[model samples]
Target chain A: MNGLDPGPLLFFVFGWFFALNIKGITDRTYRQASRFVPMIGGSVTLRIMGWIWIFVGGTLLALDFLG
Target chain B: MGAGWGGGGIGYSITLAETQTPDGKTQIGILTSKSVHSAGADFGLSATAGKFYSNADDIGQLEGKGLDKGGSAKFGLGLYGNHQTEVGTTNSKGEGVNVIEYGLGAGLGAEIGGGYSDAKSRWQTEIGSDKK
Candidate 1:
Protein backbone atom coordinates (compact mmCIF):
# COMPACT_ATOMS: atom_id res chain seq x y z
CA MET A 1 0.00 0.00 0.00
CA ASN A 2 2.87 2.34 0.79
CA GLY A 3 4.04 2.25 -2.82
CA LEU A 4 0.73 3.42 -4.18
CA ASP A 5 0.81 6.55 -6.32
CA PRO A 6 -2.65 8.09 -6.56
CA GLY A 7 -1.91 10.70 -9.19
CA PRO A 8 -2.96 8.62 -12.19
CA LEU A 9 -6.13 7.32 -10.60
CA LEU A 10 -7.19 10.76 -9.48
CA PHE A 11 -6.64 12.13 -12.97
CA PHE A 12 -8.74 9.36 -14.45
CA VAL A 13 -11.66 10.14 -12.17
CA PHE A 14 -11.43 13.84 -12.91
CA GLY A 15 -11.39 13.03 -16.62
CA TRP A 16 -14.54 10.97 -16.31
CA PHE A 17 -16.20 13.71 -14.35
CA PHE A 18 -15.44 16.27 -17.04
CA ALA A 19 -16.12 13.99 -20.02
CA LEU A 20 -19.50 13.15 -18.56
CA ASN A 21 -20.36 16.85 -18.56
CA ILE A 22 -22.02 16.50 -15.21
CA LYS A 23 -24.46 19.32 -14.66
CA GLY A 24 -23.04 20.17 -11.27
CA ILE A 25 -19.53 20.73 -12.66
CA THR A 26 -20.64 22.46 -15.83
CA ASP A 27 -23.05 24.69 -13.96
CA ARG A 28 -20.44 25.75 -11.46
CA THR A 29 -17.78 26.36 -14.10
CA TYR A 30 -20.15 28.26 -16.36
CA ARG A 31 -21.37 30.42 -13.52
CA GLN A 32 -17.86 31.38 -12.49
CA ALA A 33 -16.06 31.57 -15.86
CA SER A 34 -18.89 33.21 -17.77
CA ARG A 35 -18.19 36.41 -15.88
CA PHE A 36 -14.93 36.92 -17.77
CA VAL A 37 -14.89 34.67 -20.82
CA PRO A 38 -18.54 33.94 -21.50
CA MET A 39 -17.82 31.68 -24.44
CA ILE A 40 -15.78 29.19 -22.43
CA GLY A 41 -18.55 28.68 -19.92
CA GLY A 42 -20.24 26.09 -22.12
CA SER A 43 -20.47 22.32 -21.94
CA VAL A 44 -18.34 21.65 -25.03
CA THR A 45 -15.15 23.07 -23.54
CA LEU A 46 -15.63 21.21 -20.28
CA ARG A 47 -16.10 17.95 -22.11
CA ILE A 48 -12.91 18.49 -24.08
CA MET A 49 -11.00 19.10 -20.90
CA GLY A 50 -12.42 15.91 -19.46
CA TRP A 51 -11.32 13.76 -22.38
CA ILE A 52 -7.85 15.18 -22.22
CA TRP A 53 -7.62 14.36 -18.55
CA ILE A 54 -8.77 10.83 -19.22
CA PHE A 55 -6.17 10.30 -21.93
CA VAL A 56 -3.38 11.66 -19.75
CA GLY A 57 -4.48 9.62 -16.79
CA GLY A 58 -4.68 6.46 -18.86
CA THR A 59 -1.20 7.08 -20.22
CA LEU A 60 0.16 7.58 -16.73
CA LEU A 61 -1.49 4.39 -15.56
CA ALA A 62 0.02 2.47 -18.41
CA LEU A 63 3.48 3.81 -17.69
CA ASP A 64 3.25 3.23 -13.96
CA PHE A 65 2.41 -0.42 -14.31
CA LEU A 66 4.03 -1.34 -17.61
CA GLY A 67 7.24 0.59 -17.27
CA MET B 1 -8.23 31.16 -26.48
CA GLY B 2 -4.46 31.30 -25.99
CA ALA B 3 -1.41 29.52 -24.56
CA GLY B 4 1.71 30.70 -22.66
CA TRP B 5 4.51 29.59 -20.32
CA GLY B 6 7.05 31.06 -17.86
CA GLY B 7 9.21 30.05 -14.88
CA GLY B 8 9.27 32.01 -11.62
CA GLY B 9 8.19 29.72 -8.86
CA ILE B 10 7.66 27.23 -11.71
CA GLY B 11 4.41 26.52 -13.53
CA TYR B 12 2.87 25.48 -16.85
CA SER B 13 -0.64 24.96 -18.26
CA ILE B 14 -2.73 24.09 -21.33
CA THR B 15 -6.19 25.53 -21.95
CA LEU B 16 -8.92 26.08 -24.62
CA ALA B 17 -11.97 28.35 -24.53
CA GLU B 18 -14.76 29.74 -26.66
CA THR B 19 -14.11 32.33 -29.35
CA GLN B 20 -17.29 34.33 -29.08
CA THR B 21 -19.61 35.39 -26.31
CA PRO B 22 -22.27 32.92 -25.25
CA ASP B 23 -24.86 34.66 -27.36
CA GLY B 24 -22.46 34.59 -30.34
CA LYS B 25 -21.34 38.20 -30.24
CA THR B 26 -17.96 39.46 -31.40
CA GLN B 27 -16.14 41.64 -28.85
CA ILE B 28 -13.11 43.90 -28.64
CA GLY B 29 -11.84 45.81 -25.63
CA ILE B 30 -8.98 46.20 -23.14
CA LEU B 31 -9.42 45.16 -19.51
CA THR B 32 -6.78 46.32 -17.03
CA SER B 33 -6.22 46.52 -13.29
CA LYS B 34 -5.34 49.12 -10.68
CA SER B 35 -2.12 48.11 -8.88
CA VAL B 36 -1.72 48.95 -5.21
CA HIS B 37 0.85 47.66 -2.73
CA SER B 38 0.82 48.09 1.05
CA ALA B 39 2.11 46.29 4.08
CA GLY B 40 -0.38 43.88 5.67
CA ALA B 41 -3.03 44.74 3.13
CA ASP B 42 -4.60 42.82 0.21
CA PHE B 43 -5.94 44.37 -3.00
CA GLY B 44 -7.16 43.05 -6.36
CA LEU B 45 -8.81 44.09 -9.64
CA SER B 46 -11.03 42.21 -12.14
CA ALA B 47 -12.59 43.35 -15.40
CA THR B 48 -14.02 41.75 -18.55
CA ALA B 49 -13.50 43.46 -21.88
CA GLY B 50 -15.76 43.04 -24.91
CA LYS B 51 -19.41 43.82 -25.56
CA PHE B 52 -20.79 40.46 -24.45
CA TYR B 53 -22.69 38.32 -26.98
CA SER B 54 -24.48 41.33 -28.36
CA ASN B 55 -21.57 42.98 -30.22
CA ALA B 56 -18.88 42.16 -32.79
CA ASP B 57 -15.13 41.95 -32.08
CA ASP B 58 -12.78 39.65 -30.12
CA ILE B 59 -12.63 39.39 -26.32
CA GLY B 60 -9.86 38.49 -23.86
CA GLN B 61 -8.28 39.47 -20.46
CA LEU B 62 -5.23 39.51 -18.06
CA GLU B 63 -5.05 39.31 -14.26
CA GLY B 64 -2.77 38.60 -11.23
CA LYS B 65 -1.88 39.54 -7.59
CA GLY B 66 0.97 39.53 -5.03
CA LEU B 67 1.79 40.27 -1.37
CA ASP B 68 4.58 42.25 0.31
CA LYS B 69 5.25 41.66 4.01
CA GLY B 70 1.63 42.63 4.73
CA GLY B 71 0.10 43.67 1.37
CA SER B 72 -1.38 41.92 -1.65
CA ALA B 73 -2.53 42.61 -5.24
CA LYS B 74 -4.56 40.60 -7.81
CA PHE B 75 -5.75 41.09 -11.38
CA GLY B 76 -7.49 39.11 -14.22
CA LEU B 77 -8.35 39.45 -17.94
CA GLY B 78 -10.12 37.45 -20.68
CA LEU B 79 -11.03 37.52 -24.39
CA TYR B 80 -12.10 35.28 -27.38
CA GLY B 81 -14.54 33.29 -25.33
CA ASN B 82 -11.63 34.52 -23.32
CA HIS B 83 -7.89 33.90 -23.01
CA GLN B 84 -6.61 34.51 -19.46
CA THR B 85 -3.28 34.76 -17.59
CA GLU B 86 -2.88 35.14 -13.82
CA VAL B 87 -0.06 35.47 -11.27
CA GLY B 88 0.25 35.82 -7.49
CA THR B 89 2.76 35.66 -4.62
CA THR B 90 3.49 36.63 -1.01
CA ASN B 91 6.62 37.75 0.85
CA SER B 92 5.98 37.60 4.59
CA LYS B 93 9.49 38.65 5.67
CA GLY B 94 9.77 41.53 3.20
CA GLU B 95 12.37 39.52 1.33
CA GLY B 96 12.31 39.26 -2.45
CA VAL B 97 9.51 37.06 -3.77
CA ASN B 98 9.14 35.47 -7.17
CA VAL B 99 5.96 33.93 -8.55
CA ILE B 100 4.69 33.39 -12.08
CA GLU B 101 1.95 31.38 -13.83
CA TYR B 102 0.56 31.00 -17.37
CA GLY B 103 -2.56 29.25 -18.65
CA LEU B 104 -3.88 28.59 -22.14
CA GLY B 105 -7.11 27.66 -23.88
CA ALA B 106 -10.57 29.20 -23.66
CA GLY B 107 -11.38 26.91 -20.73
CA LEU B 108 -9.69 25.10 -17.84
CA GLY B 109 -7.53 21.99 -18.28
CA ALA B 110 -4.39 20.99 -16.38
CA GLU B 111 -1.44 22.73 -14.71
CA ILE B 112 1.85 21.65 -13.12
CA GLY B 113 3.26 23.99 -10.46
CA GLY B 114 5.52 24.32 -7.42
CA GLY B 115 7.48 26.89 -5.38
CA TYR B 116 10.48 27.29 -3.08
CA SER B 117 10.26 29.15 0.23
CA ASP B 118 11.69 29.19 3.74
CA ALA B 119 14.61 27.02 2.66
CA LYS B 120 12.28 24.33 1.36
CA SER B 121 10.55 23.49 -1.91
CA ARG B 122 7.07 22.07 -2.42
CA TRP B 123 4.69 21.11 -5.20
CA GLN B 124 1.17 22.49 -5.39
CA THR B 125 -1.79 22.86 -7.72
CA GLU B 126 -2.29 26.33 -9.12
CA ILE B 127 -3.78 28.69 -6.57
CA GLY B 128 -6.45 31.42 -6.63
CA SER B 129 -10.21 31.61 -7.19
CA ASP B 130 -12.53 33.17 -9.72
CA LYS B 131 -14.67 35.99 -8.43
CA LYS B 132 -18.10 34.82 -7.29
Candidate 2:
Protein backbone atom coordinates (compact mmCIF):
# COMPACT_ATOMS: atom_id res chain seq x y z
CA MET A 1 0.00 0.00 0.00
CA ASN A 2 2.69 2.50 1.06
CA GLY A 3 6.41 2.29 0.35
CA LEU A 4 8.26 -0.62 2.00
CA ASP A 5 11.53 -1.62 0.41
CA PRO A 6 12.56 -5.25 0.54
CA GLY A 7 16.24 -4.29 0.66
CA PRO A 8 15.96 -2.69 4.08
CA LEU A 9 13.96 -5.62 5.28
CA LEU A 10 16.75 -7.93 4.21
CA PHE A 11 19.32 -5.83 6.04
CA PHE A 12 17.16 -5.72 9.12
CA VAL A 13 16.83 -9.50 8.99
CA PHE A 14 20.56 -9.90 8.57
CA GLY A 15 21.22 -7.63 11.51
CA TRP A 16 18.72 -9.57 13.55
CA PHE A 17 20.45 -12.82 12.67
CA PHE A 18 23.81 -11.41 13.66
CA ALA A 19 22.47 -9.98 16.87
CA LEU A 20 20.65 -13.17 17.71
CA ASN A 21 23.55 -15.56 17.06
CA ILE A 22 26.38 -13.36 18.40
CA LYS A 23 27.03 -15.64 21.33
CA GLY A 24 28.02 -18.66 19.25
CA ILE A 25 29.95 -16.57 16.76
CA THR A 26 31.86 -14.61 19.40
CA ASP A 27 32.68 -17.76 21.37
CA ARG A 28 34.08 -19.57 18.37
CA THR A 29 35.96 -16.57 17.10
CA TYR A 30 37.62 -15.69 20.39
CA ARG A 31 38.37 -19.22 21.52
CA GLN A 32 40.00 -20.39 18.31
CA ALA A 33 41.30 -16.99 17.39
CA SER A 34 43.14 -16.63 20.69
CA ARG A 35 45.23 -19.70 20.02
CA PHE A 36 46.90 -18.43 16.87
CA VAL A 37 46.57 -14.74 17.70
CA PRO A 38 47.30 -15.10 21.44
CA MET A 39 45.56 -12.46 23.53
CA ILE A 40 43.30 -11.87 26.51
CA GLY A 41 39.88 -10.37 25.86
CA GLY A 42 36.55 -10.01 27.60
CA SER A 43 33.95 -12.45 26.30
CA VAL A 44 30.79 -11.00 27.78
CA THR A 45 31.77 -7.50 26.84
CA LEU A 46 32.25 -8.57 23.27
CA ARG A 47 28.82 -10.13 23.11
CA ILE A 48 27.14 -7.07 24.55
CA MET A 49 28.89 -4.71 22.18
CA GLY A 50 28.29 -6.94 19.19
CA TRP A 51 24.65 -7.02 20.06
CA ILE A 52 24.59 -3.26 20.29
CA TRP A 53 26.19 -2.78 16.92
CA ILE A 54 23.87 -5.16 15.11
CA PHE A 55 20.77 -3.71 16.69
CA VAL A 56 21.72 -0.09 16.21
CA GLY A 57 23.14 -0.61 12.77
CA GLY A 58 20.16 -2.61 11.71
CA THR A 59 17.68 -0.05 12.98
CA LEU A 60 19.39 2.89 11.31
CA LEU A 61 19.75 0.93 8.08
CA ALA A 62 16.09 0.08 8.08
CA LEU A 63 15.18 3.71 8.69
CA ASP A 64 17.45 4.85 5.89
CA PHE A 65 15.96 2.40 3.48
CA LEU A 66 12.42 3.42 4.25
CA GLY A 67 13.07 7.15 4.49
CA MET B 1 50.45 -9.40 39.21
CA GLY B 2 52.39 -12.25 37.54
CA ALA B 3 50.11 -13.09 34.64
CA GLY B 4 47.70 -15.54 36.30
CA TRP B 5 45.03 -12.85 36.31
CA GLY B 6 45.40 -9.16 36.69
CA GLY B 7 43.14 -6.37 37.89
CA GLY B 8 39.72 -5.59 36.54
CA GLY B 9 39.11 -2.83 34.04
CA ILE B 10 36.07 -0.62 33.74
CA GLY B 11 34.17 -0.49 30.47
CA TYR B 12 31.27 1.35 28.90
CA SER B 13 29.14 0.78 25.80
CA ILE B 14 26.21 2.34 23.91
CA THR B 15 23.81 0.31 21.84
CA LEU B 16 20.48 0.60 20.08
CA ALA B 17 17.38 -0.54 21.96
CA GLU B 18 13.65 -0.66 21.33
CA THR B 19 10.45 -1.37 23.20
CA GLN B 20 7.30 -3.30 22.31
CA THR B 21 4.00 -2.02 23.63
CA PRO B 22 0.82 -4.01 24.19
CA ASP B 23 -0.51 -2.36 21.05
CA GLY B 24 2.41 -3.81 19.06
CA LYS B 25 4.37 -0.61 18.63
CA THR B 26 8.11 -0.09 18.96
CA GLN B 27 10.68 2.74 19.01
CA ILE B 28 14.45 2.83 18.81
CA GLY B 29 16.91 4.57 21.11
CA ILE B 30 20.21 4.34 22.99
CA LEU B 31 21.16 1.64 25.48
CA THR B 32 24.21 2.28 27.63
CA SER B 33 26.11 -0.01 30.02
CA LYS B 34 29.05 0.20 32.37
CA SER B 35 31.09 -2.74 33.66
CA VAL B 36 34.16 -3.85 35.57
CA HIS B 37 36.20 -6.89 34.56
CA SER B 38 39.48 -8.60 35.24
CA ALA B 39 42.34 -8.00 32.90
CA GLY B 40 42.54 -11.74 32.47
CA ALA B 41 38.95 -12.81 32.80
CA ASP B 42 35.41 -12.16 31.58
CA PHE B 43 33.21 -9.07 31.87
CA GLY B 44 29.48 -8.38 31.61
CA LEU B 45 27.66 -5.09 31.19
CA SER B 46 24.06 -4.13 30.43
CA ALA B 47 21.63 -1.22 30.61
CA THR B 48 18.01 -1.00 31.67
CA ALA B 49 16.25 0.23 28.55
CA GLY B 50 13.05 1.54 30.10
CA LYS B 51 10.23 1.14 32.54
CA PHE B 52 7.11 -1.05 32.33
CA TYR B 53 4.43 -0.28 29.78
CA SER B 54 0.96 0.56 31.06
CA ASN B 55 -2.21 2.22 29.80
CA ALA B 56 -3.91 0.61 26.85
CA ASP B 57 -5.87 2.48 24.15
CA ASP B 58 -3.62 5.54 24.47
CA ILE B 59 -1.69 5.69 21.22
CA GLY B 60 -1.37 9.51 21.42
CA GLN B 61 0.26 9.33 24.85
CA LEU B 62 2.45 6.35 23.92
CA GLU B 63 4.51 8.25 21.37
CA GLY B 64 5.57 10.63 24.13
CA LYS B 65 7.24 7.74 25.93
CA GLY B 66 9.72 7.53 23.02
CA LEU B 67 12.39 5.50 24.82
CA ASP B 68 12.47 7.96 27.69
CA LYS B 69 10.11 5.84 29.77
CA GLY B 70 7.53 3.04 29.60
CA GLY B 71 7.68 -0.35 27.87
CA SER B 72 10.04 -3.22 28.74
CA ALA B 73 13.82 -3.36 28.75
CA LYS B 74 15.77 -4.51 25.70
CA PHE B 75 19.12 -6.34 25.37
CA GLY B 76 21.75 -6.92 22.69
CA LEU B 77 25.09 -8.65 21.96
CA GLY B 78 28.53 -6.96 22.28
CA LEU B 79 32.05 -7.35 20.88
CA TYR B 80 35.27 -5.32 21.30
CA GLY B 81 38.89 -5.41 20.26
CA ASN B 82 42.00 -4.28 22.17
CA HIS B 83 45.59 -4.18 21.09
CA GLN B 84 48.08 -5.03 23.81
CA THR B 85 51.73 -6.05 24.11
CA GLU B 86 51.92 -8.27 27.17
CA VAL B 87 51.43 -12.00 27.85
CA GLY B 88 53.87 -13.11 30.51
CA THR B 89 52.69 -16.59 31.38
CA THR B 90 52.11 -20.06 30.00
CA ASN B 91 48.35 -20.53 30.50
CA SER B 92 48.69 -24.24 29.78
CA LYS B 93 49.17 -26.59 32.73
CA GLY B 94 51.37 -29.11 30.94
CA GLU B 95 55.07 -28.59 30.31
CA GLY B 96 56.85 -28.34 26.98
CA VAL B 97 54.69 -25.51 25.79
CA ASN B 98 55.48 -22.05 24.48
CA VAL B 99 53.26 -18.97 24.77
CA ILE B 100 54.05 -15.28 24.60
CA GLU B 101 55.14 -12.42 26.77
CA TYR B 102 54.18 -9.68 24.33
CA GLY B 103 51.70 -10.78 21.73
CA LEU B 104 48.32 -9.77 20.38
CA GLY B 105 45.89 -8.74 23.05
CA ALA B 106 42.13 -9.17 23.01
CA GLY B 107 39.13 -6.76 23.22
CA LEU B 108 38.94 -5.87 19.54
CA GLY B 109 37.08 -8.73 17.96
CA ALA B 110 33.55 -8.53 16.52
CA GLU B 111 30.58 -10.88 16.61
CA ILE B 112 26.81 -11.04 16.18
CA GLY B 113 24.72 -11.65 19.32
CA GLY B 114 21.15 -12.43 20.42
CA GLY B 115 19.16 -13.06 23.62
CA TYR B 116 16.13 -14.70 25.29
CA SER B 117 13.47 -12.96 27.31
CA ASP B 118 11.56 -13.88 30.42
CA ALA B 119 8.36 -12.40 31.83
CA LYS B 120 9.84 -9.03 32.77
CA SER B 121 13.38 -9.05 31.45
CA ARG B 122 15.55 -10.15 28.55
CA TRP B 123 18.65 -12.26 29.22
CA GLN B 124 21.61 -12.15 26.91
CA THR B 125 23.65 -15.28 26.22
CA GLU B 126 27.48 -14.91 26.49
CA ILE B 127 30.01 -16.59 24.27
CA GLY B 128 33.79 -17.30 23.85
CA SER B 129 35.10 -19.28 26.77
CA ASP B 130 36.67 -22.79 27.04
CA LYS B 131 35.53 -23.55 23.50
CA LYS B 132 38.99 -24.44 22.29
Candidate 3:
Protein backbone atom coordinates (compact mmCIF):
# COMPACT_ATOMS: atom_id res chain seq x y z
CA MET A 1 0.00 0.00 0.00
CA ASN A 2 1.59 3.25 -1.05
CA GLY A 3 -0.85 5.13 1.11
CA LEU A 4 -3.77 6.81 -0.71
CA ASP A 5 -3.82 5.05 -4.00
CA PRO A 6 -4.96 7.37 -6.80
CA GLY A 7 -6.41 4.44 -8.67
CA PRO A 8 -9.53 4.54 -6.57
CA LEU A 9 -9.54 8.28 -6.89
CA LEU A 10 -9.63 7.89 -10.64
CA PHE A 11 -12.53 5.49 -10.37
CA PHE A 12 -14.39 7.94 -8.18
CA VAL A 13 -13.83 10.59 -10.76
CA PHE A 14 -15.28 8.23 -13.37
CA GLY A 15 -18.37 7.94 -11.22
CA TRP A 16 -18.55 11.68 -11.10
CA PHE A 17 -18.19 11.84 -14.84
CA PHE A 18 -21.02 9.37 -15.17
CA ALA A 19 -23.25 11.61 -13.15
CA LEU A 20 -22.16 14.54 -15.21
CA ASN A 21 -22.92 12.58 -18.33
CA ILE A 22 -26.45 11.85 -17.21
CA LYS A 23 -26.86 15.43 -16.05
CA GLY A 24 -25.45 16.53 -19.42
CA ILE A 25 -23.33 19.27 -17.96
CA THR A 26 -19.78 18.16 -18.64
CA ASP A 27 -20.33 18.24 -22.38
CA ARG A 28 -22.02 21.59 -22.18
CA THR A 29 -19.22 23.00 -20.10
CA TYR A 30 -16.59 21.61 -22.41
CA ARG A 31 -18.39 23.00 -25.42
CA GLN A 32 -18.58 26.47 -23.90
CA ALA A 33 -15.01 26.38 -22.60
CA SER A 34 -13.17 24.77 -25.46
CA ARG A 35 -13.12 24.62 -29.25
CA PHE A 36 -13.17 20.87 -29.38
CA VAL A 37 -16.47 19.99 -31.08
CA PRO A 38 -19.91 21.44 -31.35
CA MET A 39 -22.17 20.83 -28.38
CA ILE A 40 -23.60 17.34 -28.62
CA GLY A 41 -25.99 15.46 -26.39
CA GLY A 42 -24.71 13.87 -23.19
CA SER A 43 -24.68 10.42 -24.71
CA VAL A 44 -22.14 11.20 -27.40
CA THR A 45 -20.30 14.08 -25.74
CA LEU A 46 -19.80 12.55 -22.31
CA ARG A 47 -18.61 9.22 -23.68
CA ILE A 48 -15.88 11.02 -25.57
CA MET A 49 -14.85 12.74 -22.38
CA GLY A 50 -14.87 9.44 -20.54
CA TRP A 51 -12.38 8.07 -23.04
CA ILE A 52 -10.15 11.08 -22.49
CA TRP A 53 -10.37 10.65 -18.74
CA ILE A 54 -9.35 7.00 -19.10
CA PHE A 55 -6.32 8.00 -21.11
CA VAL A 56 -5.36 10.61 -18.54
CA GLY A 57 -5.67 8.08 -15.77
CA GLY A 58 -3.49 5.64 -17.65
CA THR A 59 -0.83 8.27 -18.18
CA LEU A 60 -0.85 9.19 -14.52
CA LEU A 61 -0.53 5.55 -13.52
CA ALA A 62 2.40 5.15 -15.86
CA LEU A 63 4.15 8.21 -14.43
CA ASP A 64 3.56 7.03 -10.89
CA PHE A 65 5.03 3.64 -11.71
CA LEU A 66 8.02 5.17 -13.48
CA GLY A 67 8.76 7.51 -10.61
CA MET B 1 -28.87 -10.37 -28.01
CA GLY B 2 -32.52 -9.89 -26.85
CA ALA B 3 -35.58 -7.61 -26.89
CA GLY B 4 -38.36 -7.18 -24.35
CA TRP B 5 -41.55 -5.18 -23.63
CA GLY B 6 -43.37 -4.59 -20.30
CA GLY B 7 -44.12 -1.52 -18.16
CA GLY B 8 -42.25 0.39 -20.84
CA GLY B 9 -39.72 -2.48 -20.66
CA ILE B 10 -36.91 -2.77 -18.03
CA GLY B 11 -35.33 -5.06 -15.39
CA TYR B 12 -31.97 -6.51 -14.18
CA SER B 13 -29.87 -9.70 -14.37
CA ILE B 14 -27.60 -11.62 -12.00
CA THR B 15 -26.46 -15.11 -13.02
CA LEU B 16 -24.64 -17.67 -10.88
CA ALA B 17 -22.56 -20.53 -12.26
CA GLU B 18 -20.68 -23.48 -10.78
CA THR B 19 -17.53 -25.12 -12.01
CA GLN B 20 -17.54 -28.36 -14.00
CA THR B 21 -17.13 -30.83 -11.17
CA PRO B 22 -16.58 -34.58 -11.51
CA ASP B 23 -14.15 -35.31 -14.34
CA GLY B 24 -12.69 -31.84 -14.08
CA LYS B 25 -13.16 -31.89 -17.82
CA THR B 26 -14.41 -28.87 -19.71
CA GLN B 27 -15.67 -28.28 -23.25
CA ILE B 28 -16.47 -25.32 -25.50
CA GLY B 29 -19.31 -24.50 -27.90
CA ILE B 30 -20.76 -21.81 -30.20
CA LEU B 31 -23.84 -19.60 -29.75
CA THR B 32 -25.86 -17.55 -32.27
CA SER B 33 -29.04 -15.56 -31.68
CA LYS B 34 -31.51 -13.38 -33.54
CA SER B 35 -34.44 -11.53 -32.00
CA VAL B 36 -37.16 -9.24 -33.33
CA HIS B 37 -39.21 -7.81 -30.46
CA SER B 38 -38.24 -9.69 -27.31
CA ALA B 39 -38.91 -13.05 -28.92
CA GLY B 40 -36.69 -15.33 -30.97
CA ALA B 41 -34.55 -18.45 -30.83
CA ASP B 42 -30.93 -19.58 -31.16
CA PHE B 43 -29.67 -22.59 -33.14
CA GLY B 44 -26.21 -24.07 -32.99
CA LEU B 45 -24.18 -27.28 -32.45
CA SER B 46 -21.79 -28.76 -29.89
CA ALA B 47 -20.14 -32.06 -28.91
CA THR B 48 -17.53 -32.05 -26.14
CA ALA B 49 -15.14 -30.04 -28.33
CA GLY B 50 -14.55 -33.33 -30.12
CA LYS B 51 -17.85 -34.20 -31.77
CA PHE B 52 -20.26 -31.97 -33.63
CA TYR B 53 -24.03 -32.27 -33.59
CA SER B 54 -26.48 -30.40 -35.81
CA ASN B 55 -29.91 -28.81 -35.43
CA ALA B 56 -30.22 -27.17 -31.95
CA ASP B 57 -32.47 -24.18 -31.36
CA ASP B 58 -34.01 -22.13 -28.52
CA ILE B 59 -36.10 -19.03 -27.91
CA GLY B 60 -34.67 -15.58 -27.00
CA GLN B 61 -35.20 -11.84 -27.53
CA LEU B 62 -33.50 -8.58 -28.43
CA GLU B 63 -33.83 -5.74 -25.89
CA GLY B 64 -33.23 -2.01 -26.19
CA LYS B 65 -34.30 1.39 -24.79
CA GLY B 66 -33.41 5.06 -25.27
CA LEU B 67 -32.88 7.52 -22.42
CA ASP B 68 -36.00 6.83 -20.37
CA LYS B 69 -36.34 9.57 -17.76
CA GLY B 70 -38.11 8.36 -14.67
CA GLY B 71 -38.24 11.02 -11.96
CA SER B 72 -35.04 12.72 -13.10
CA ALA B 73 -33.25 9.36 -13.20
CA LYS B 74 -32.84 7.53 -16.47
CA PHE B 75 -32.71 3.73 -16.29
CA GLY B 76 -34.22 0.51 -17.65
CA LEU B 77 -33.76 -3.25 -17.83
CA GLY B 78 -33.68 -5.92 -20.56
CA LEU B 79 -33.99 -9.72 -20.42
CA TYR B 80 -33.51 -12.52 -22.91
CA GLY B 81 -33.03 -16.31 -22.90
CA ASN B 82 -32.43 -19.42 -25.00
CA HIS B 83 -33.24 -23.14 -25.03
CA GLN B 84 -30.40 -25.54 -25.86
CA THR B 85 -29.35 -29.11 -26.72
CA GLU B 86 -26.22 -31.24 -26.23
CA VAL B 87 -24.47 -30.28 -29.42
CA GLY B 88 -20.80 -29.46 -30.08
CA THR B 89 -18.05 -30.16 -27.49
CA THR B 90 -19.58 -29.26 -24.13
CA ASN B 91 -19.03 -32.31 -21.88
CA SER B 92 -20.92 -31.18 -18.77
CA LYS B 93 -23.68 -33.68 -18.04
CA GLY B 94 -27.14 -33.29 -16.53
CA GLU B 95 -30.15 -31.20 -17.56
CA GLY B 96 -29.50 -27.57 -18.53
CA VAL B 97 -29.47 -25.16 -15.58
CA ASN B 98 -31.70 -22.12 -15.22
CA VAL B 99 -30.51 -18.71 -13.98
CA ILE B 100 -31.71 -15.14 -13.49
CA GLU B 101 -29.58 -12.04 -12.89
CA TYR B 102 -30.29 -8.36 -12.29
CA GLY B 103 -28.02 -5.35 -12.79
CA LEU B 104 -28.37 -1.64 -12.05
CA GLY B 105 -26.54 0.89 -14.21
CA ALA B 106 -26.73 4.45 -12.98
CA GLY B 107 -25.29 7.92 -13.59
CA LEU B 108 -23.72 7.92 -17.04
CA GLY B 109 -22.74 4.37 -17.95
CA ALA B 110 -21.87 3.10 -14.52
CA GLU B 111 -22.55 -0.54 -15.23
CA ILE B 112 -21.80 -3.22 -12.64
CA GLY B 113 -22.14 -6.81 -13.78
CA GLY B 114 -22.03 -10.13 -11.86
CA GLY B 115 -23.24 -13.58 -12.87
CA TYR B 116 -22.68 -17.31 -12.63
CA SER B 117 -21.97 -20.04 -15.20
CA ASP B 118 -22.25 -23.77 -14.76
CA ALA B 119 -21.70 -26.86 -16.86
CA LYS B 120 -25.24 -27.12 -18.17
CA SER B 121 -27.36 -23.96 -18.12
CA ARG B 122 -27.32 -20.27 -19.10
CA TRP B 123 -29.19 -16.97 -18.57
CA GLN B 124 -28.56 -13.21 -18.98
CA THR B 125 -29.95 -9.85 -17.77
CA GLU B 126 -28.91 -6.25 -18.41
CA ILE B 127 -29.77 -2.94 -16.69
CA GLY B 128 -29.44 0.52 -18.20
CA SER B 129 -30.94 3.08 -20.64
CA ASP B 130 -29.76 5.62 -23.19
CA LYS B 131 -31.62 8.96 -23.17
CA LYS B 132 -29.59 10.87 -25.67
User: Largest DockQ belongs to which candidate?
Assistant: 1
Q: Measured against the native two-chain assembly using Cα atoms, what DockQ does each of the candidate structures obtain, in the order listed?
A: 0.08, 0.04, 0.04
> Model 3 over residues B1-132: C-alpha lDDT tens digits?
111223223222111222223443222222222212221112100101112222211212111111111111112111222232322322234333232222222112111222111232223322231323
TM-score of each: 0.36, 0.27, 0.22
Cα lDDT tens digits for candidate 2, B24-124: 44534433223233332223222212223222222222221111101111112222222211112121232221211111112332222221111111112
Identify the leading candidate in terms of TM-score. 1
The fnat scores of all predictions, in order, read 0.12, 0.03, 0.00
The clash count of every prediction, one per candidate, is: 32, 25, 34
Put down candidate 2 lDDT per residue, A1-67, tens digits, no spaces.
1544333243344334334554476566456545654434344534543454456445645555655
Best by lDDT: 1
- In terms of lDDT, model 3 sits at 0.28
- Give candidate 1's root-mean-square deviation (CA, Å): 17.4
Off by over 4 Å in 3: A1-67, B1-21, B24-91, B107-132
RMSD of each: 17.4, 20.7, 18.0
